[model samples]
Target: MSIQLGSNQEPPKQERSAETRRQLLDAAADELLDGGFARFTTHGVARRAGISRGAQQHHFPHKHRLVTAAVHHLAERSLQQLEGITSDGSLNSTRRVLDALFEQYAGPLFAAMLDLSLAARADEQLRDAVQREEHTVNRMIDEWAHRRLTGCDDAPADFDELFAMAISTVRGVAVLRLLGHSQESVQRQWKYTRDQLLRLLVENRS
Candidate 1:
């Protein structure tokens, strides 16, 4: 019989721990996206992350914190992408940047946020947490929009209003996918809006 030494196993490396944390957050994001709060489960997330239940708990002692952290993780990643894209003074580049920003609203992070938002409508503590996270995200996006609008020649006096409207339209378009709208239909509307918005920006008009 071979005897295993109990003390021989090495503890997980710092890099490994961070990786596991990321995996758990990603799994939580997916869980929130797929079924919102109704289907969220600590065990389910742990399994999805390929980690043991204890391991998950060790990383996130509370489930709510984990969910919030998952949103934070996604926000951080989006900010990185936002920073990477250069703002060349061209209408096409502007469109690309806008598309990327809109993508963050349409992607898995947004789904997870929708889950949190719905839950927060009734839960006070959760609502507070979600609001704080949302405020952080909104602040970042606010700066991003302002940055994109800068250095463009002859921007309209109502440029702020126009930008707000455009953001709202893109966000609504994102929600349409959740309402079972076909991609073809969504794409059609999106393209029309894209073209018109591109022109407005390129022309620097309302």
Candidate 2:
């Protein structure tokens, strides 16, 4: 006989599975941030997640898969946050867009991405995974920028190139933060870069 569910009953199996995966990915991201890829391990992630090793292994069979999945998970979350920020009607200015993008790159997500990227350089398998995810995320950002910045189906022919440069510049500024540059110095440099990018965007659209 099937048991009747009560208020204290556990969640359904599918939901529990999804929650476990989320926990593992969150733990994996923290592990990467706390200890770069060189020291990242599924065991450590499982420990951080407060789950058994078997459980994490059941979800992510290998270290590379776990790490890459963690990066993808974090990237998706960051992109969602960006979408939310850009959706606000009051923030419909080029400078605001740049600010949102800069804030995105300056967060822990980018720090985790940097860790994966550095480690990927020496690991062929991980490199492929990281590059694939990077390409996917970049494409998503390109589409997002086109839609948000232009608000039209037809963007300028050079729009993508110009946005790519802007993103690269912002990412460079983010690296400065990771490199231990003072907050004041980073802000000074970003202000200069932001103004230059704003000018470029205006010229490109004009």
Candidate 3:
């Protein structure tokens, strides 16, 4: 099964196949957002997408595939959002991107991901996918940190550890925010925490 998003300027008529795929994905995301991952079943995705169960199965054979695809879709959207941050060609770009990401996802997205991780304990495939996404996000964060470190050409040997620490710090804020902390308070504390983390990274740079 293939997924496509047809261009609006193509013609007067919308493509049915493309529209169906979009609906499926969009609806799945909405379901995940509305309820936790446990609440997101294949039937629920189909109902939300307004597509037949057979069609959903054609695209995604199982619930795990649908969930993994949704994770990838969200990751791609995030990368797109960071495109500008990457292109800034300044060390601050790294920090800014991290800040923006935490700000954007500290609420619902982070909460949903946490829910998914807890759900993964009983599902091996889901556990693997969640781990994969964690590693991918960590790699991105590590690369950004390396770029921003004082010596970009020769980062510290423990760069990964340091990067993981910073990621944890941000994720802690996300959890707190998701649990009803005020946005103003989260942002205030987050900025201070980020600055301190960056300073430490800079100091540790080889």
Residue pairs with backbone overlap in model 3: none
**Model 2: lowest-lDDT 10 consecutive positions:** 84-93
Query: Across residues 25-98, which tens digit of lDDT does each residue of candidate 3 receive?
Result: 87786788788786789899998787999989988888887876676566555555655554232347546756
lDDT of 1 by residue, 1-206 (tens): 99786986766799789888999998887777777877888999999999999999999988778878878877877788787775644787778877886677777777778778988898888898898998888778767866875556677777777778777787888787656689889778777887787776665543
By how many angstroms RMSD does model 2 differ from the true structure? 3.0
Q: Distance (Å) between predicted and true CA of 155, model 1?
A: 4.5
What TM-scores do the predictions have? 0.76, 0.83, 0.70
Residue by residue across 82-167, what tens digits does model 2's lDDT show? 77645322224767778877776777777777777887898899899988887776677656765667654445678778877888
Query: Which residue ranges in model 3 land beyond 4 Å of their true spot?
Result: 1-22, 87-95, 104-107, 137-162, 201-206
Candidates sorted on lDDT, descending: 2, 1, 3
Q: In the order shown, what is each candidate's alpha-carbon RMSD?
A: 5.0, 3.0, 6.5
Clashes of each: 0, 0, 0
- lDDT scores for all predictions? 0.79, 0.79, 0.70
